[model samples]
Target chain A: MEENTTTEKIFPPGSVGLVKSQDFHFAPGEVLELDCGRTLRDVTIRFETYGTLNADKSNVILVEHALTGDAHLAGYHTAADKKPGWWEEMVGPGKPFDTNKFFIICSNILGGCSGTTGPGSPDPDTGKPYHMDFPVITISDMVRAQKHLIDHLGIKKLLAVAGGSMGGMLAIQWPISYPDVVESCLAIATSSKISPQSIAFNWIGREAIMSDPTWNNGDYTEQPQKGLSIARMLAHVTYLSDQSMSRKFGRKLQTAEDYSFKFDMDFSVESYLNHQGTRFVERFDANSYLYITRAIDYFDVSDSADGDEHKVFEKVKCPFLVVSFSSDWLFPPYQAKELTRLLLENGNDVTYCDIKSHYGHDAFLLEYETLGKLVDNFLDNIYKEKEGK
Target chain B: MKIAHNPSDSEPILSRSDLVMIADMIPENAKVLDLGCGSGRLLRVLKARKNARIMGVELDQEKLIQCMERGVPVIQADLNEPLSLFADASYDYVILSRTLQAVKRPDLILQEMLRIGGKGIISIMNFGQLDARMQMLKGHMPVTKRLPLKWYDTPNIHPGMLSDFRDMCREKGIKILKELPVSQHRDFLRFLAPVCPNLFASNAIFVISK
Candidate 1:
């Protein structure tokens, strides 16, 4: 049976199988303008695609990645790779994204570190890394850069723009920023604006990184591992719920049945967070973290509407699907409901759901059964409607 | 599951007669919002027949997926809770079919329906029919074709008669634009239902405006 299983398949059922990433570099003369009133040149975007684009080019879908996520959304990069894409379950041949029927594209955001133009990328003018010199960005800025990529690909209108968490913010921005180009949107487990509580958490995470002596004011020879790990540890707590933490750890000791009587990371939850922090520091740059979180903090779709959140989407014409988790304190269900209300007030067709889950904000990554079905059916319906059948 | 048979061959096959009657009340190209829309059968018929812009709110996740499968826009929400997400007078018609008894506050839901929509259509099971009255006379709870479940196990917590609905509407200052007694079975009750709706009809559909 072991030999049969190993020889029978190169990839699992519903898998996108082996995939490769591609890069898109902006033309020299293009010189993209930023929301912060600065101009950037030689911008690069790392992206990946699945399925075929079709004859009419109407089967394209742009999937946005959340914080700390990259262009690799589904399938194995290599045959021996232990982990598939972050959204492996939702983006395969028969999964919610249904790669067989629609061409799926996911790109690293402009301020993202994974093969995208960010703080670590070299500055053409200075002949060194941009570092702190990288223009301050916003969610809209990331989406603006994405629009250029979509236009370059010659897709006149996208079937849908979808994502969760910070990705959700980008999804929301796409429809508003380019209403005529996007046919629909799926914003899951996200808010239109960052709440004060969220801002405070981001502040603490940034503070942890800046406090490290090795950080060297964002110009350190070596990456600030300790500070970045501490930041990741604190940020990880916000991604989980009290119920989830209690169920997973429940004050369980790491190696002993009794208390250690000293602060040596004895609790299981502490050890788990430490491991997450250390793992994150290895792949992510601290400077990129500062820029991306700041972009998230500055995101407010209602800025053009005199701070009236209800009128943010008045000019947007596409239908929307908004999903939130019951235990997601970071982007609570009420916040999502508020966005739905705003859409309804403008007479926009919007479907909203608060999925019952204990996985908190991370429910967007987990809870595939319920969330996946919602996306699958939602996107299918939109496609059918667009076809006029 | 027992499928309700409709006598009209041109109408949708899966929908009950009461749902057909409710769909008939809506005009062509009207925007509709259906509360407690189970599997979106009525909305599908409306979309196909009237070319109506359709949306639904269903509590059951499975039914919500079924609605999406039928290309009907739907929101997952409890009818018992406040439906404040929908703006006032946003829809041309709001429908609550065969779900009045199951909700915690049918009166409040009616008001909310009319508040969000220009007109509200409701189809309720008539508990005062002759079969139920006969069961009561025999000192047993009702077990009619329409009200099939036992009293203790039923989700219908506030079942009422057609007269009760009229009186509630009068007291609540809700104008009943039209009312129709519906009987799906091909029996004498179908003839008598229209004459004495409170005692013979299996169900009643009401079109009301605020």
Candidate 2:
């Protein structure tokens, strides 16, 4: 584990070099109390920071990652790495996030297989991987653990909390959970509660992962690669829209003269999905997928406030920018509109934009130019308002 | 009577006399909501001159971006839908300028405006004006300066006369606090608009409250 003090000196002041991820471990006495009536001891958070923290620490911007994302939010870890961070287009020296002016921090969420504490983490009591023994965590629990990381960094308030999809869920939860610490929230392709259809899709993915013969009831020595791959294939379909699928691969053969009519992957779309599934299983854990999906399924902001969503959102002191893609069927525009209505009813400043896109739920990540400009303007306005105050 | 020509190069697209009249009625430092705020021109002017805290509701994507570019906070929403997001009497003024006829339910929108605001300012082009009535006599729909487009291309789905709106307000128990007639004609016709606004006024602006 690299210490914070040492990592801070790795990059010279005013340079825009790629920052490396570091592990921050809290002692057993500093356990994170979970909503499931269980506690996670010696919690470790893997986070990466971009840009420099200003003198007052008011320029901090916390970027939350989605269900399958890690702490590598921007820049390549090494020059040899083929790919940059997951959201590299939106966060750089002169990008919409503008690392030149603001400090950016992204951490792997709790119950995540990344460098965070999750099912893959060792159970201190048993001296083995927690696996199924890990307590079910909620989005609020993930946020609470992130609060610890932010406090460790000595940031009093974040200029903005932003994310898309599952990341957007955390963005919404941040202001509700820590109203005084977040100045503004930008929630994209997310909702206050998961729809029944979304829950059904997630259930199907979990079933695929658990039904594999090699699962060994969550105690297997070897990872459940087959089941995890199938589950990922199921999810990869939902991330793309029918229009996008057809436009990219419409009944085209996958390097074949004619269809073989067998169970083989003949169509280009099927081949693409298989490739995605194969690549995903290499980087993600099956047990972590089950736990994180469960956390998302159980998320409902109203549940924490006596079943009143208005009461839950009444605690939000910051303005919000709720964005949704036109073709995102999974987390559609109406869901975002409903959330915006609730926020407005509570007398909070909320702006909503149903961006026209055919990129489905992943539009926020794919359509960076439009999303980037809107977010840039929104953040610039917020910064100006704060300066005036 | 001298008719006003197309706006000169010096003026903005929103420099219509009716919009200017509406902007004049708004006080300084007020909390204002501009419904169907196309490109946020009125709200921008209000923010600059009155120092008002303004929010806008616009449905068009391009206009919404324009509003954002001008640093005006706007929600992308159709005016035909209910403004249930806003609390009752939350805004000092709610201005629906030149968009009443285009809505599906103008009466409900007016009620919602008065419900969510202390005062509601609505400006509508009168379909029962002299030119419209004369066109009706000639078996043609009017396409005057206020109602510039042809019937097929116009967005005014529910073209209403000034008297019709007054009657609707009366039936709904809404008090008309003030009324201003906007006319293109400079002298005699402009003077006659106040006397018989339903027949002579090209457009009308009404301030109402519940």
Most accurate candidate by DockQ: 1
True contacts kept of 2: 0.60
lDDT of 1 by residue, A272-291 (tens): 99999999988999999999
lDDT of 1 by residue, B142-175 (tens): 9876678999999999989999999999999999
Off by over 4 Å in 1: A1-9, B1-12, B186-188
Let me know the DockQ for model 2: 0.53
Error of 1 at B58 (Å): 0.6
Per-model chain A TM? 0.97, 0.95
lDDT string, candidate 2, A263-375, tens digits: 89999998998899889888998899999999999988898798988798877878899999999998999999889888887777778899999989888899987888889
- By summed lDDT, which 10 consecutive residues of candidate 2 chain A come out lowest? A6-15
CAPRI category for model 1: medium
List candidate 2 segments past 4 Å from native. A1-17, B1-16, B27-30, B45-53, B87-92, B131-139, B171-173, B184-188
